[model samples]
Target: MNEKEILERAYLEAQKIVSENSFREFDTSLCENVDFLIDKIGSNKSIVSALATSLLKKITNPEQDIRLHRTDFENGYSARSLDTKVVTPFFKRHFPKYANKESAFLTLSTRERIKWNKNEGKNLKIRSKALKRSFLNVFEQIEDGNANPRVYLNYLFAKLQALSSKDELIFQLAKKQSGRSGVLNINLIIEMLQRHFAEKLSSRLPVVAIYSIYEILVPNLKRYDNKRLLPLQVHTSSDKHGFGDIEIYGDDGKPFEIIDIKHNISIDADLIFDIIKKTTTTSIDRYYILTTFPDGFETKEIEKAVNEFIIQTKTQKKIDIIANGIIPTLKYYLRFIDDYNLFIKKYTNNLVKDAKNSTEIKTFHIDKWIKILKEYKINNV
Candidate 1:
């Protein structure tokens, strides 16, 4: 079967298992095999993606041997390619939390003499011989046609569901707290949000929050009247043109302004150098390197380099580079916003829709905001 057909089949099977609760009847041994892998790997997503992709491909075409994952196996198809092109996309679409750019085969190299044969686990990075034996033993059953692939797939999906379960401590706390009722204090709200950012809920949360602020501020700012704020790119994305975390376009559709938000990381000379490379090619009018780090940029030498680079870029390329603390920038932007509620709503919506954020991160954002409102009595009745 083609990659698309196999992906569709896997999705259908997953839906069937989930909707009908068919995994309840999976054999204990099959479930135990997945458990063993999880215990050994401690929720290594790459291994899980690799195994799922291999099993789904096997079930799709049982006649073809899927032993050597990197090879085409004379079936006019490469399992590694299938993992990269098809399975990764499926993971992104159906299970965005575990989606990555490349395939798991990148880590599990089955090349040269190290084929997925009897000695497969020995060649792997697994240190213990017993663990290696257990690893091979699990796949041995599948390779020898002993374990039913469909049943195995059900158990695998079941194990993944268990691993992906959400934490509810914050949810419980939020439920018990009394809702506050009073007029909103913009300063208090900013302080609460700043504290939230300080918690470092997730690396993606700050970027999204910053983007949400820009979403509100950009339309009103006279300087951005002709400029357009670009859509927020996935935090894990690598190909964001030459711009940084956030990009603004001019009337000509070229990047006019860029902002790169760093989470709890000090901007040093190395980062400044990278920015220099990025700015050389684009005619961007301004670049902002905002960081959650209290110290902002690194040592005095690095700070000097940053200032010099800024002046150099401004003089040579007309590219203005400003390095500052993220929270302070947000606080300044909040002064321009008339309705602070809009900021909260935008941030909440972005958190809900962000594919990269875990359930804990999303719940914490809502719960923290709730806690802040109750403590400050900032909520409307």
Candidate 2:
């Protein structure tokens, strides 16, 4: 079988084991090692990817004494391309949470492919010794034929599947608790949202909230209804085609407007210059730079640059550049939204689907809203 087919077969086998609970019969030191790695590793995906990639390579050619890592030389094949081209894409499709992080080999590709013995990679050095030892133990067992490779694969895949399930549960519970407090006061809603954004648990939270607000306001506003708001792009992705955090496509399938959100970062002349440079090629109707910064464009330099750019772009490109704080922007937008309750519902729903946001960020929104709304309800009574 081809390499991809072999990997697929193993994955399918692992899935079957996960479903039928048959892997419990084969549980051994290898399975425990995998559990320990997952527990200790926490969010470090590179090490997990490295472990999976090494196991796959070894499983493909059982005869070769596959080292933990190696490059294409007279001795053996390089795992770099396989990790980047094959394994990375596979993980992206099946496990999106880990997709943002790159494989260990991809990070180490710049250095000479010196065979790293004992499953050691440059990135693994910062991790705990138990994690390092667990990886080495698993690799040695698989290489020496002390443990069944297929069993190890089953445990790894099952462990990851279990983790995804646990995270999904948290997201769902958060969504369930994201109800409104009966009264629809724009001022109260805005205050609750401000509190949530101020926690600063994750930058992705503010972006998600802004995007959710746009999802409601864009369609209702007559001027923006003619345009379509683009979905949120992956946070770590670089190829944004000169668009900002939130993009609106015009009827002509071009960028109509762009909104970039900053979390507590100072907005200065240099920031405005960077924005102008990025949008030089696109003829956008409006560009907004909204921030949660305590001070809103405090310097004269920032104010002057914004005003001058607005004049030049309005005349030259017809793009109106506006900068403001997020709370004020939300207050203005919420004025137009018919039902403030819908904003809470949409925000909660978006939080569940946002893969880039961590579980902590999702829970923070729900917990903060719950506390705020309860207090509001009590005081009103």
Candidate 3:
């Protein structure tokens, strides 16, 4: 078989393996199998090896499963550790000629190797740092090789860390490469979404909460726009209320006509009325009340209530008013809860609130509000 034919077969087999497994351990471990398939079909070793390595790297390292350790205890004991150690075998498999067997014996030659001394107290900090540095050095050597798929894969993997930092350079780079003209890398897109959402929810809340929102919205955003919209929080104070949160703006740098966000069961109608009234005074073109309990309130009832409020504002003309709750679509809600739980785990108790009874609700459900705007055909310039 030709190179193309071998690649075709290997790709099909890899797809099958990925489909059968969970997202965690899907296609990452299929490097050997992919290479074997290519070899059996008489493909070029170098090209097939590169392709197989790329596929393996692409499918492996699900960010959701990346090990995050919190060493709060003395000597840096961490509850979060990987079950299996990840060893870079490229030096052994691909660069045996360069492997320095003598380096392993250098420590032995120095006679400095010593077993753990109970009285000496474990220097876990030094040990952990040294281990991490050693592993990184090996990775560097693997990456420095010829145009192997693993080299690019490793580069991409390292780039993933920058996404969390809200690094504009990294984001721009990913956006540039996301198109047909570029690398067409989905992992970069995912990393961008994760970081975008992470930064969005990072303020006034715990990292975990932001992460939860990201998990829920990232996949949905990918489904809708093939990218995530940067969410912005707008602060406004009403005359009636001393100070409050009002609207959320999209990346377009304009606040949406309508704003929607999750709230606790105990919602303050007075505050809601104040927000609606204050919004009218400002540039807000329309109003909406989005809640977690969509089914709990009748749409007609809220509509009637809103109409009454409009009548009360006799000075201003009647405006479109939308009040409804998101029904928590199966796919979107599940992802939201997963990311929310993760966020809660990483942040403070006050920053993370249960949906049961939290009064500090704000207007920032930008994604859902966007949907509502589209549904109503309401456009705000």
RMSD in order of candidates: 4.9, 4.5, 21.2
**CA lDDT of every candidate:** 0.66, 0.68, 0.31
Q: Pick the candidate with the highest lDDT.
A: 2
lDDT per residue as tens, model 2, 265-367? 8677667777778878777788888888875677778777767766776687666888888888888877877877788778777877774232224444555
How high is each candidate's TM-score? 0.77, 0.78, 0.24
Q: Give residue 180's lDDT in candidate 1 (0 to 100).
A: 28
* Sort order, lDDT high to low: 2, 1, 3
- In candidate 2, stretches whose alpha carbon ends up further than 4 angstroms from where it belongs are 1-33, 36-43, 63-80, 83-89, 100-115, 118-141, 144-147, 179-181, 237-242, 298-318, 356-381
Ranking under TM-score, best-scoring first? 2, 1, 3
Off by over 4 Å in 1: 1-13, 19-22, 33-44, 63-65, 72-77, 101-138, 158-182, 237-242, 299-305, 356-381
User: Over all chains combined, what TM-score does candidate 1 have?
Assistant: 0.77
Report the C-alpha lDDT of model 1 over 1-381, residue by residue, as the tens digit.
676675566567656676676765776666666767755443245566677777777787776555666553444346667778777887777666565556655553322235455655578654555555555665677888467676676566655554444323444334333232345556776777776765545566678778888899889899898989887765543223447878889999888889998888897766766787877766888888889887787677877887887787678777788888787787787788887767766765665555333232455565665667566665542
Q: What is the lDDT of residue 75 in candidate 1?
A: 43
Error of 2 at 196 (Å): 2.3
